[model samples]
Every structure is written in C-alpha cells, then in structure tokens.
Target: MQYFLVSNDPDRRARWHDRLKAAGLNVTGEYDPSAVIVTIGGDGTILYAARNYLEPRILPVRAGSSKGNRAAFDVDQLVETLQALEDGHAESSSRTFSTLTAEADGKELEGGFQALNEISLHHSSPVLAATFAARIEDDTTWEFPELIGDGVLVATPFGSTGYFTAITGETFTDGFGVAFNNIHTPADTPEMVLCSESVVVEVELLSTKRSSGAVLTRDDDDTPYELSEGETITIRAGDRTVELLDVI
Candidate 1:
C-alpha cells in the first residue's frame, strides 16, 4: 500500500523517510486519500493526521519524548513491521474511533468542527470562574443546576485516556464522558458522568449581571469558538468514525 509520512520533527521525518524507502516500501511525497498516513511523532500527530485527512488509514509510530499512548509501533520495529506486511506474514489491521460535534445557540458552526477526542468549554479569563448550566438527555432529560467553575469538557471513550482522565481520574471503554473543570460550587457534584454515545450534552454560559463567557476548543485546534453569556453550546457524538491502521 502507498504511504504518506508526517511528523512535527523535520529531522525525524527525514530519517524515517530514508528507512521506509530502504525497506522497499511505497512512500509518497504528497498526500493521497488512498494512501495510509504514517504518523512518525507523538500521539498528537495521530490526531493531526486524522484531522487533516478524510477517513485516511493511520499508522502511528512512536517518536520523541512524549508518551505515545496511541502509537501502533515503535521506531525499532518500523522496518520489520513493513516487511511483515509486504511478506503477508502480518496483515495491516485497524480500529474505528468515534468523533464529536458542536453547535452554538441551536445553529451548527461554519467549520463543521468534529473532534476525534474531546470538546472543551472553558472560562475566557484566567482569573474568573464562569457560571454554567448543563442539560443531558439519555433515557430521560436531566437539567443540572448552574455551576461555578473554570468550565467543562465532553470526551469520547477514545478520548477518555487524555484530558478526561487527567481531570476525572477515570477512563471509559464506551460512550461520552462529561467532567467539570475546577468547580467551586455544589461541592458534592459528581466529578464525571459516563453517558451513552447517543446522549446529547448541552452546556450554556449563564448570563448574569456581569459579562461572562467561555471558549470552546477542540482536539488541539488553534481556533477556539467563543461563547457569550446566555449562549448555549451543544455537544454530541459525530455520525462518523476514524480508522487507525496496524494497531497491535
């Protein structure tokens, strides 16, 4: 299969490019939708590949000092893995991961933002905690009382291992995980909630006498969607899924 190599580190990319070519693998300079993405960086590179390519197969190779939690192979095993696939001794495999989508005030955003991991809404200012309210729909509709906190995040199971785990100290195998960020009120509120993938989570930055707002960010995207006071941001599971290649 044709492969496209990508890395945030230029030196690592050049080195790996030579190795793959030396192994007699078919590598391409330009991205092809049909080509498998060989991500040669940290776990973040995997997310980057998935975001830029449309349903492209991903082969995540661990690199650098970061913890490559989503990596499929290590550097030492790279050429051997390719040989195995070439010889039909080991076949390429894949796993499907879910994604997320958001809307503001009942309208879908222009970019059709879909996050392979989590979508977070945080207080706009560092010194201020925003007041927010959440409405979750599962078997029944439940409205949570207003909360005073830094913000909140909704993560998929594939995302549970990232920020979700850091904030809630837990991971899930399926469904969406909802967690509050540094909440100050309703002290007894559950740290996290595991809801069905089919559930809908709506959060609003409450409008008070003071101007309050939050910033909505997705999966390492540089762009942050802004939410004004009284504006509701809706988060839900996307209809599509991302496939990772050669997962062991």
Candidate 2:
C-alpha cells in the first residue's frame, strides 16, 4: 500500500524509512493524496501531519520518551502495527475525531482546523487581561457579559485530557467543553459543558496600551491571529473529520 512518512527527527525518520522499505512498503517523503500518513513521533508530530495533510488517515507511532496524550503506539510496536495495517486487520482500531471551524467578522478565518486538542483565545499582553462576552447559538437567553479573564477555550471530546483539563480540572468523554483561564472571579467555577452547538464569543482588550490585543490559536500552532477590540469569533463543529489508527 502507498504510505507517507512524516517525522521531524532525522534518526527516527531514517530508521522507519529503512524498516518500511525492507518490508516492501511504498513510502514517500512527500504527501500523496491516496497514501496513508504515518507519523513517527509524538502528538506534536501528529498535529503537524494533520495540518499539512488534512484528508489522509494518520497512524502516529511514538518515537521519544514522552508518550503524549494522543500517541496511540510506541516505536517498538511499529513492525506489528504496520503488518496489521497492511493485512487490513487494523480497521477495527480506527477512531474518528471531529474538527472545528472559526470565523471572524463574518469571514472564515479557519475553514476546518482539525484539532485533536483545543482552540483558544488569549490576551496578547501577559500583564493585561482580556474582556469577553459569550453566548450559545442554541440558547439565546444564555449570555455571559463582561467576563474579565486571560482567555477562553473550546475543546473537543478527544481534547478533554489536554488543555481543557489543565484549566478546569475536569474531562468529558463526549461533547465539547468550554473553560475560562485566570478569570477575575476566583469563586466562580470557570467551566461549562455544551452539546455539539456553535458558540459565539466577542473579545475586547481591557488595556489601552499600544500593541495590546487578543490572539486566537488552535492546538500547538506557533502563530496566532490577532484580534481587534470588539471583534467577534465564532466556533463550531467542522464538516471534515480525521481518522486515527488505534495502535494501543
């Protein structure tokens, strides 16, 4: 079967390349539309693969000591996993994860960002907190105005164990989760559970200092979009989904 190998580490990449080649697997360094993308690293590598190759099935094999939350198999299991995949015995191990889409000012900022983790908005300046107002699309009566905090996040069920848990100390096996970060009101539990419904949040920079703003980031992306005061960002479930091979 056609396959694409994705890895940041040179040694791990070479090792897998040699092994897969010896096993008679057609592996390519470049992404191919019909190829199964195999990631030979941690969860970060998986996210990178997803960003570059959106539609391919991903099989993430942990390479280093850090067995991240999303890693399904370790490097030691590579041979067996590949054998199973080649034999079509790994079909039962497949799991699908839904994506998220974000829009700003009625323009689509992200068409469909597949985040196995979460999407977040935070204050640009560390010293200044951002002000926000939120409302659920399904419930018009529910509104949170003037939420002064560092930021907010929308996490999928698969992402519950990551940043969502870090902020709220809770996780959910299903449904999306919303959590507030460093809110001014310490007494209030800054978490909410929502069904698969869209959420709209408007952000306002509390600080008037120059270059003060908010940022929108998805997963572990290094770059973030800057948000002007009073800008509205809409988050909802995406149409596209990602299929992950369960190697554990």
Candidate 3:
C-alpha cells in the first residue's frame, strides 16, 4: 500500500520513515492517489495533515502525551499497527469525523478550509472585548441582537470535547455546538445544540471597546482573518469528512 508520513519533529519523522521502510512499506514524499497518510504526533499533527491533504485515511500515532483525546496509537505500537494494516486486519477499525467550513461575507475562504475541531472568532486586540450579533438557523431561526464578548465559536461533535467543552461546560455525542466566549454580560452566555444539517451562523462584529477589529480562526491555524465591524461571517458544516484509523 502507498503511504505518506508527516511529523513536525525531525527525530520522529526520521524514526517513522526508517521503521516504515524496514517494514517493507512503500512510503512516498508526496500525497498520491490511494495513499494512507500516517501522522506521528499529537492532535495538532492530525489537524495539520487534514488541512493539507484530502481523501486519505489517516493513522495518527501518539508521539506526545498519553492523555491525547484524538490519538489512536502510541509510538511503541507503530510497527505492530503497520503490520496489522499490512495484513489487512485493521481495515474495519476506522471512524469518520465531519468538518466545518467558514465564509467571510459572501466569499468562501480559500481551499474551503475545514476544521476537525471547531471554528472560532475572537477579538484582534488582547486588551479589549468585541461585541457581536449572532443568528442561528437550525429547526428555527434564533437571533441575538447584541452578544458582547471576547469571541464566539461553532464546534462539531468530534470537537465537542475540546474548546467547546472548555467554554460551555457541556458535551455532545452528535450534532453541532455553539458557545459564546467571555461575554461582558455574565448572565447572557449563549450555547446551542443543532442537528447535522447545515447550520447557518451569521456573526457581525458590532463594536470593540478598545480594539479596532476581530479575527476568525480554525483549528490549529497560525494565521487569522481580520473581521471588520459590519462584516458578516457564515459558518456551516463542511461537505467532506475525515477518516481516522481506529487501531485495535
């Protein structure tokens, strides 16, 4: 089987490269058709791989912490895992996770970026809080004229355990989740659970106490898109899903 390996650390990359070669697996430098992408790192590595590659089944090896919620296997089990895969014993141990897409105004973001975790919007300046208006379309339409907070986010079920739970103190097995950041009005914290059908969320930055703008970001992205005061951002469930190898 053809495979592509990715790792941020040089040592881990070299180690996996050698191991996969020693196991007689064909490892390629570039993503090719019918290739299984193997990532050796934490959850961030998995997110990075998903952002850069499409339609490849991913096998995430836990090269970092043992407590990683998204990791499927540890480093010590790499060889055995690959062996099982080679023997066709691990084909059934896979799960599909959905992604989220975001658009600014009417223009879609490049690559139609998908986030496996959550899509977040926050104040651009550190010292000030940004005010926003949010509208949700699920089974019905719900609108909040004024939601004053640091930011807001929309998360998928696969992401519910991450930043979503940290902000809302709630977890979901399915459907999408929405939560407000540090709202100035402590009593006005808004949270919602919507079905898998595309959720249309429109957010407008009304004002900022001291900052000039707000920014939008997705899971693990280093760069952020600036948000103007009256500009609107539309977020919805992505069309594609990520496949993760569930090692047994």
Candidate 4:
C-alpha cells in the first residue's frame, strides 16, 4: 500500500524509512494524494504531520505519539499498527477534525491555522491582559475590561481533552459537533454560550500601549502575532474538518 511518511527527526526518519521498507510497503517523503498519511510520533507529531504534510489534501490521519509533552496514545505498538495498515485493517477507520480561522488587520492569516483542538488568544507580551469584545458568528459584539492574566481559548471536543481539560473546561465527547471551552474570563464564558457553529468572534485589544497583549493561535500554536490594543482578531470555526483514522 502507498503511504505518506513524515517525521522531522532525522534519526527517526531514517529508522522508519528502513523499518517501513522492510515491512514491504511503498513509502513517500511527500504526501501523495492517493496515499494514506501515517504520522510516526506522539499526538503532537501527528498534528504536525496533518498540518504541514497533508493539510490541503485533508486526508484521514493515522497517528501515534512516541513521547514528548504527553503521549495520549502508545508508540511501542506502532509497528503492529503499521502492519495492520499493510494488512488492510485500517480501512474501517474514521475520525473527525476541527479547525479555526483568524484574520489580523485585513489580510487572512495563512498556513497551519487549522487546529484539531481549540483556538486560543493569549498575551503577546507580559503586559495588560487581553481585553476586547467577543461575539459569536451573527451576533453583535460586547466589549470587556482589561484582562488580568494571559488570554482565553476556544477548543473543540478533540481539543477539549487537551488544554481545555487542564483549565477546567468540561470534556467534550467526539462526533457530537464542536465544543467551545477553556474560557478564562467571566465575560468570555457567556460570550461562548452565545456562540454558534462556525461563529465569527472579534477580539479587540483595549490596551493602548500597543501592549500587543493578545494574539490568536490554532491547535499547534507558535504563530507570529503583531496585534495591539484596538487591533481586532477575528476567530471562527473553519470549513475544513479533519478526518482521523480509528473511531476512538
């Protein structure tokens, strides 16, 4: 079977290249539209693979984490899993993916904004809290006072198990539609309640220092944000949904 193999670690890359080859499968460094993508690593690596390797193509992800920040699943048995794919055991897999959209200034941000988890707005720098009006799609905007801590985040059920759980957002079951959780501020909580599917939210920085206190990010994070107070950040559910292999 043809598969898309992606691994940033040179050592792991070489190891898997040899291993998968020995397993009797055709592997390509680049994503082949016709090939299933197998991300070899932890969930984070899987996320990275889905984003950078097969983002536009949007294929079902067969992922496992080796280890890192966390290993939601196991990696020791990946070889067995690989064998399953080769044996046609992965064909019955199915999973749903979630995404977020953000627009700064006027132009839309590009590349890797889609998050399988939640989209968050946090402090750009150590300064005043991120304060702005948040409105769900099709709703009017409501303003908030200066923020005290970092910022707020919105996560889906897939993401609910991640940061949202740590922050006390309720765990959202998968395949029940999208979830909005991990809200830090009181106003933001009510704001999300009013949110709808694919709702558009605008966060306007109220701090005048151009404190750039707030920035928007998708699931994987690590994006460059140059926003200041009064600069608006527009966030909404994305049209692109991820397809995860394996129901669980």
Candidate 5:
C-alpha cells in the first residue's frame, strides 16, 4: 500500500525514512491523495495532515514528548503495525470526524473556510470584551441578544476536547458544542450548549467600543477573518468529514 510520512522535524523524517525503507516500505516524495498519511509527531501533526489532506487516511504515531490525543501507535511500534496491515494480520478501521465551515455576511470565506475543530469569533482588542448577539437555529432555537464577552466559539464533538473543554470545563460525546468566553455581563448569559451537528450558529458583531470588532478563527490557523461591526458570521458543520486510520 502507498504511504507518506509527515513530520516537522527533518532528522526524525530521515530516520523514519531509513526505517521504512529497511522494512520494505517506499515513501512517496510527493503527496498522493490515495496514500495513507503516516504522521510522526503529536496531535498537532495529525491535525495539520487532517486539514491539508482531507480525504487521506491518517496513521498518527506518537514520538518523543509530544502529546497526541489521536495517536494510534508509538514510534517503535510503527513499523510492526504497518507490516501487520500489509500482511493482512491486522486491520485499520476508519474513524470519521465532522468538520466546520463558516461564512461572513452570507458569503463563504476564501478556500471555503473549512476547519477540523472549532470556529471562534472574538474581540480583536486585547483589553475590552466585544458585544455580540448569538443565535442557535436548530430543532429548538436559542438566542442571546447581547453577549458582552471575550468572544464565542462553535465546536464539533472532536473539538469539544480542545478549547471547548478549557472554557466550559466539559467535553461532549456528540453534536456541536457552544461556549461563551469570559462574558462580562451576568444578565442574558447563554449557557454552553451541546446541540446537534445540524445546528447553525449566527453571531452578529454588536461591539461599539472604539476600534472594536471580532476576528473569526478556524482551528489553530494564524490568519483569521476580520468581522466588522454590523456584520454577521455563520458557523455550521461542513459536509466533508475526516477519516483517521485506526489500527485494530
């Protein structure tokens, strides 16, 4: 089977390359959509692969001191695990995870604004909290007229274990999770919701503070979309899903 090894460390990749070659596995120099991605790092490595290669099956291998939530095997076990798959002695199951898509003022962002984790809209300023109105349109509608806070986020089940957990101190099994970030006003505070994946979240920038506006962040992307006042942003589950190759 065709496979690719991904790593940020060049030395590690070189060593892994030698190991794989010794074990009789060829590493593709170029990314092949059909090839299984073998990432040699932590959760960040896996997430990076997940975002860049949407359709490839990922084999996350933990290495060094990296903490990987989705790593399937350690570095020492990688060769053996992969051999098992090749010999049909073991199998890899696909675990599908949902993704996020966002739009600004009804127009989809560039490159479709797809994310594997959560989408956030927050105050761009450092000291002041932004005011925004959030509405969850689903089976049962819920709305907060004016939320004065750092910002808000919409997270998928896979994302619930990340920032959503840090903010709400909870993780959910299914559906999208919503968290209110550092709300200044106690009144009209909206509780965190773990609603269906079909739910649509709308955030209206209402902050009137000087130079105040919201920045929309997708996953851990460094570049975020600017959300001006009076503009609305929508977050929803994307149709595309990520498949991880789980060794079993």
Candidate 6:
C-alpha cells in the first residue's frame, strides 16, 4: 500500500526509507497527496499530524514522546503494526469523532485547527471573573447563553482522560462523546453547572476593566483576541468528525 512518513530523524528516516523500499512499498518523507500518513514521532507528532492531515492519512507510529503526549501506541509495537498492515495480517476498526471550533469576540479562528482534546478559556486575572457565553448546537431553550466563572472549558470523552480529568475529578471511557464543565473556583463565586452536554458555548469578558484578559485557547491555538466588556467566545462541535485507523 502507498504510505507517507513524517519525521525529522535523518538516520531513522533513511533506515525506514530503505526498509520500506525493500518491502516493495512506496514511501516518502514529505506528505504524499495520495498516500496514507504515518507519523513517526510520539504523541506530539500524532497530535501534530492529526491537525495537519485531519482524518484519513493522519495516523501514528509512536517514534518517541514529547511533553508527555503519546501516540497511544509505541514505536517498537508500531514496527510490528506497520508490518502487519503491509503483510495484510491485520486491519483497523472505527472510532468516534468530534470537532471543536473557536470563536472569540465574534469571529471564527482563521488559522490553526479544531481540538481533539478540550477547549479551555481563562480569564487573565485571578481577582476577576470572565463570563462565558454559549449556544447549544440546535437547542431551542437558550438562543444566547452565559457561564459565569473564572474560566470554562468543554471536553470530549476522548479528551475525558486529559485536561478534563484534571478539573472534573472524574474519568470516562473514551468511547463516549460528552463534555465537562468546571466552575468551582473562587472567582466563580457561588457556583455554576459543573457539567453539561450542550453542543454550543460562547465565552466573553463579563466584568468591567476590573480584570484584563486576552485569548481563548483551543487544543493549542495561540491566536489571541481582545475582549470588550461584552466580548464573547462561542464553541460548538463541528460537522466534521476525525476518523482513526483503529488498531486496538
């Protein structure tokens, strides 16, 4: 089968190139427009590739790790996995998918990508609160919404094991597509709904200039937006879903 490898290791890259060639399969270092993507690094590489290629080709080989992110599978095992696929000894199953779109103030992010993990928004000051607004994808109850808290975030079941676990104090199976909300901080004052499955959310600066904050980060987007007194951020699962070449 046609495959593409994305890695920075000169020696390993060369080694794989030679090995794959001898195996009678075509491989390339650059993103092959018509080939399956094979990320050769750790989880960071997987996440990077996931965003770069989206669904389809963006799969991983677990070369190594960076910042505790893992490809879910390891390299040594990956060697066997790739070989199995090449030998037609194994196949992949299906996995659920979700999309995260980030809009700050009132505009959508023009760059970066939707997060596979959780979407987090924080108010810059500890002494102040930022009002997070939201709209459920197709909910008719609340046309415009708000969540008063120090900050707010939406996490999926796949992401339930990551940042979501850090806040909600709970863990869930990856097979479930859901969201978590945490509003127990001091700045949130009393409290807000700890969790909800609403598909849409809008975040904004509620208080006056009493606090200064900028940017709403999704996955890892660095693009920043200035918040007016009523500026808001809206987040909803996108129409597209990522498909993983399930191996386990």
- Name the best candidate (by TM-score): 5
lDDT of 5 at 26: 67
Q: Find the 10 residues in a row with the least total lDDT in model 5.
A: 184-193
Error of 4 at 247 (Å): 8.2
lDDT for residue 197 in candidate 2, whole number 0-100: 39
Per-residue lDDT value at 194 in model 1: 85
Model 5 lDDT tens row, 72-135: 8899998998889889999888877888899876667876788777999888887878888999
Q: Pick the winner on lDDT between candidates 2 and 5.
A: 5
lDDT of each: 0.83, 0.73, 0.80, 0.57, 0.84, 0.57
lDDT of 6 at 7: 62
Better of 3 and 5 by lDDT: 5
Residues 1-248, candidate 2, lDDT per residue (tens digit)? 67788888988888888898888778887778788788888888887877767666888778877667677778888777778867877753777877766776556685544466777888888998777776655544345666777788888877788888898888887657777887884446346655553554444443434668788888888888777776777777766677887753
- lDDT of candidate 5 vs native? 0.84
Ranking by lDDT: 5, 1, 3, 2, 6, 4
Give the lowest summed-lDDT range of ten residues in model 3: 188-197
Best candidate, lDDT: 5
Error of 4 at 216 (Å): 2.3
Model 3, span 1-248: residue lDDT tens: 78788888878788788888888888887778578888888888888888878755888888866356777778888878778877988753777888888886566776575788998888888777778888888887888888776788899877788898998788887778888888876465555555554678888878755536788889979888787778888998787788987776
Which residue ranges in model 6 land beyond 4 Å of their true spot? 8-18, 65-72, 104-107, 111-113, 125-149, 172-198, 208-211, 222-226
The alpha-carbon RMSD values of the candidates against the true structure, listed in the order shown, are: 2.1, 2.6, 2.0, 4.4, 1.8, 4.4
Question: What's the TM-score of every candidate structure?
Answer: 0.91, 0.87, 0.91, 0.75, 0.92, 0.73
Clashing pairs in 3: none
lDDT of 6 at 147: 54
lDDT of each residue in 1-248, candidate 6, tens digit only? 67777665667767776777776776776666567766667555555555666454455566644443435466566556767877779876656556566665445666543776667766766666556554444333333245555566666565666766676666665332223244543334321223344456655555554547634665644554455666666776654466555465
